[model samples]
Target: MFRSFPAMAFRTRCPVLDPAAFCFRPSTDLRNPETVISEPQAKVTLFEAAELLRNDEVVAIPTETVYGLAANAFSPAAITKIYATKNRPQDNPLIVHVSSLAMLEEILPDHRIPPIYLPVINRFWPGPLTIILPKSDRIPAIACNQPTVAVRFPSHPIARALITQCGFPLAAPSANSSGKPSPTIASHVISDLDTKIPLVLDGGQCYFGIESTVLDALRSPPAILRPGGVTFEALKEVLGMEELQVYKKHFVDVQLEMTPTTPGMKYRHYSPEAQVVLFEKPIPLGNGLVPTIDNTNCKGFELSTMVAMTILETDIESLRSSIAHEVEQLLSAGNRKFGILRTSSSSLQDITKNRGSTFKSSTEFTVVEKFLGSALHPEQVAHELFKCLREMDAQGMDVILVEGISEDREGLAVMNRLRKAASRIVTM
Candidate 1:
């Protein structure tokens, strides 16, 4: 049946799976008629997966956040390989992905489960949400550049199988090459880091092509460290919806540089090569009314190479049409060139199936459809922001304006990222 990648041999005595044994190129096959891998054989091999992981080597594993190149959290050599392969800054520590509550207890300081977090963990575990807690003495300082380390229980079976097999938390970063795009398929993994890493258990595609939501349990009422699958609204509902108190409750120290005890806390993260400019959704005053341009600072769009991003399926065209129609009416208005990265639900589904991998645990999401709807969800968008930005950026646009998503379910995840990607934030 589905066994933790059964090893052909033992770890200590087992010879490395001849790195050549793997195809440098991944199989082009996508869409497993059956969305879920109910068949035992359809799952990933775990023992071999562990052997590779233990050796301080990289293993491309799937997570709700994105496809990640993971390593033994405790091993310094393994951590270094992740940096070298992804070209990620060493100062930016990595998140530790675990399979169960037992594993978390084994690794994290066995602190009292604050009553406040109980409901949250019960609701969102084995998914994309991450809990940052006090570091266990046994943990490697490298896991968290700060005093607290970020940990998660991935819902993907293959991912859980691999992590449980490894017997240690795996420190994983998005598998794609550094600063490029986060990989969602076997090909994306291969394109970015095939030879550099050992084995990648092709587990179809990822549902949430983003990072996990990182919440700080260290705070009273709880605060979000990094946004991901779980939304702030979700957090508020579970934890007594009170206005997040600043100054006092939100006492988190932002991690930067390889500071002894935190990870993934530092760095201008989730950015694509293209410079993202945030714009106001509705026309603002002064530069207010028509023109569809925010006059407060038209300087960001002064250059003609800027592209205002919006979903092709969205009614955004009404405003766009209005802007083009009124451009002549508005004096001193500038020539704003647009490069659109529009994709319809069906077309996006096709592209996700053809290009990105499907999530093994769920079928509700696809690669392209993730950007649909409104409301900003930073975590989900963060997962694919780099990829989307990279695509538009490649076209040679000067400034990239990402259309805002409704801050609903996946939309919540999109907004956080849009806020960061857009130079200026706007609402439609």
Candidate 2:
């Protein structure tokens, strides 16, 4: 069952009195990896979460997109624990979550927002959009490795209540081990962070199963450094942003090494434990998955495909054939099990049918398949993408194959993440 902050608090902001006035609840101590906080779970009330933050202890809080490991952005000691707990690099900055514009104003250098972002903020604030702004001195250097910082105002009631109650900005990143899929539920947090943090306020599953869009309006003709819940089409609708550029395949900033303004920039993130292969084109709708065994027309591949094919056999007939051949090779090499993340347009059952009688007779074939909702409904696919990836990982599959979707609407963000997670990408 899903849960959130109180109805009264959800409707209106309520100022929480000083946490020092309340008796601090004892937090479960976890000294070993084997230690688990079961039953009543490790969920805490808004008041308790506020006290934990006041004590400079890290707690996992749910957001509209994913759970965040939150700490007082003003405290250097508290921020350091977040890095250590997630094994996150010190140089990769964290996003600051604010409850209201007033909280956002308190942290800005001039207590003013840039004029360019006013329209976007007006349209997308308190949602899944994060904006990059100049860092104020009040923000510790440890929280931002660069001169700028990323800020987000989450819409989740539990998240807003906890931040409002704490009366300070929280420096938070996805509450999972660095380089893994971000957590979308309390249990996902516990599975990865387990007693690493003091508490997890279990609001429920996230609305968008991906992270917030990291937009840098500070740049002329703003560019999307990282794609997330906010779509490119949505941002383009805002005035003065029609020429907006995406940092995905369309363009790459050579300056990223010297200036990474957002979290996903300059990092390999959202990867599962298994070796991942992504088929960039949708599996042809009507034909079976495998290509003709007759190897032909293998030249003139796309850049990613060309690079990937250098590793694959020269005789493969088509993209689908390459998939079957790769699976066979892995099976031949004694990797007996695999996993597949299918979109509505593609299916593992198709592959089984393609293999014909050989598929039934093959003793080495084992695959776990999961569907990520309809391709026509990218929103549903976006809402389930990360959680489904984590689910496949838990199944102990040796390798995971993902089907790609068109970069339209939310599919743009989906493809961006898929590119980052894939060890091999074939865009035939």
Candidate 3:
């Protein structure tokens, strides 16, 4: 059984208050970076939402990234509700959200921000970047028992306003059921968490449409635990961060996976009900021969490697052919619906438009296609990836074929999600 809740619009009027009285110390810093329009109905809704949060209840709030399931960072009970509501594992830690540097200082040991993070905070704070720092005693074990806690200062006006209104930092993770694609819009939150959570502040679609980059500057090389809205290239350009490293697919840390210090590290996340088949960029061999993958003996959920010392005239065309083969095989086994997530302008659309006519005439067949922007602009792809996945799932696709993009800028984060969501990776 599913439950429902009121998804409130986040257009509340900013009440005039004294600088000292406001939780955010600097009164001048409280204004939204974007335009601020006030509405009376939204004011009442914001107050109600804050009241619920003050009482240790979970509230879904929008951020520049994805919507977050927020609860009082200091309350273990409230934090537990977030875990129960999302069915998130206790081992997976949460990120603490703050409205101001003052609020952040309150949770830090000795009320001091680490020197190493000063440059990063200046460059990326109040945006989609999470930094892992030493946890203070005020932080509850459930939030993150580890010595370090992940914290972010969100630029979203509603999220900042809500935290300031409540007078405490919030421990929040992506506002969706665990292992599912993170919600980019309020409707996505209501669809997944609904009755599980009380209120969702609908601030419209998320600007980043992905989670914040989780950076552990405490590490020797200062590794990025998760690639997100913040790109490695951008981070590398930051002063004193030239040596930063990102944990890629090939680098496996078994201990870290089992006991993740933060979210997105230990779980199989961003997945949908339908099987996701990721088609990676083809690796060309100098020898001129077509490589063939034998799928006759492959069974359920088994990933087989296709390798050959063969050169392909057009790797992209071969990749499209390989995906078509997968679709045909599935259709022959009674799978009637398919979805294609395209990353560039290509002839892949021809498969969806023309192939159905050539399939068995008596069998019902359908194909849905969505463009995840273009590879040249990966941020656009990141923005549309999860939404398209959910839309395809809602339309009841049997399998989703996603064209993989290069690991550049936001493309790293885009491919990271697709790799986790994918059940099979077909490398040409």
* Ranking of all candidate structures by their lDDT, best first: 3, 2, 1
> Tens digit of lDDT per residue, candidate 3, span 214-279?
998888778899999999999998977889998764356788777778889877999999999888
Candidate closest to the true structure, highest lDDT: 3
Candidate 2's residue-wise lDDT over 235-272, tens digit each? 99998788898885567777884457779887899999
TM-score of 3: 0.84
Task: List runs of model 1 lying over 4 Å from the truth.
Answer: 1-44, 240-265, 274-278, 282-338, 342-387, 390-400, 406-409, 422-428
Q: Give the CA lDDT, 0 to 100, for residue 374 in model 1.
A: 14
lDDT string for model 1 (96-212, tens) is 887666677777566445466667777777688877666777666555336677777777766766676677889887887765556665666765665566677666557777667
The C-alpha stretches of model 3 lying farther than 4 A from their native spots are 1-37, 249-251, 282-312, 353-364
Worst 10 residues of 3 by lDDT: 297-306
In model 3, pairs of residues that clash are none
Kindly provide the TM-score of model 1 when superposed on the true structure, using C-alpha atoms. 0.64
lDDT of each: 0.54, 0.74, 0.77
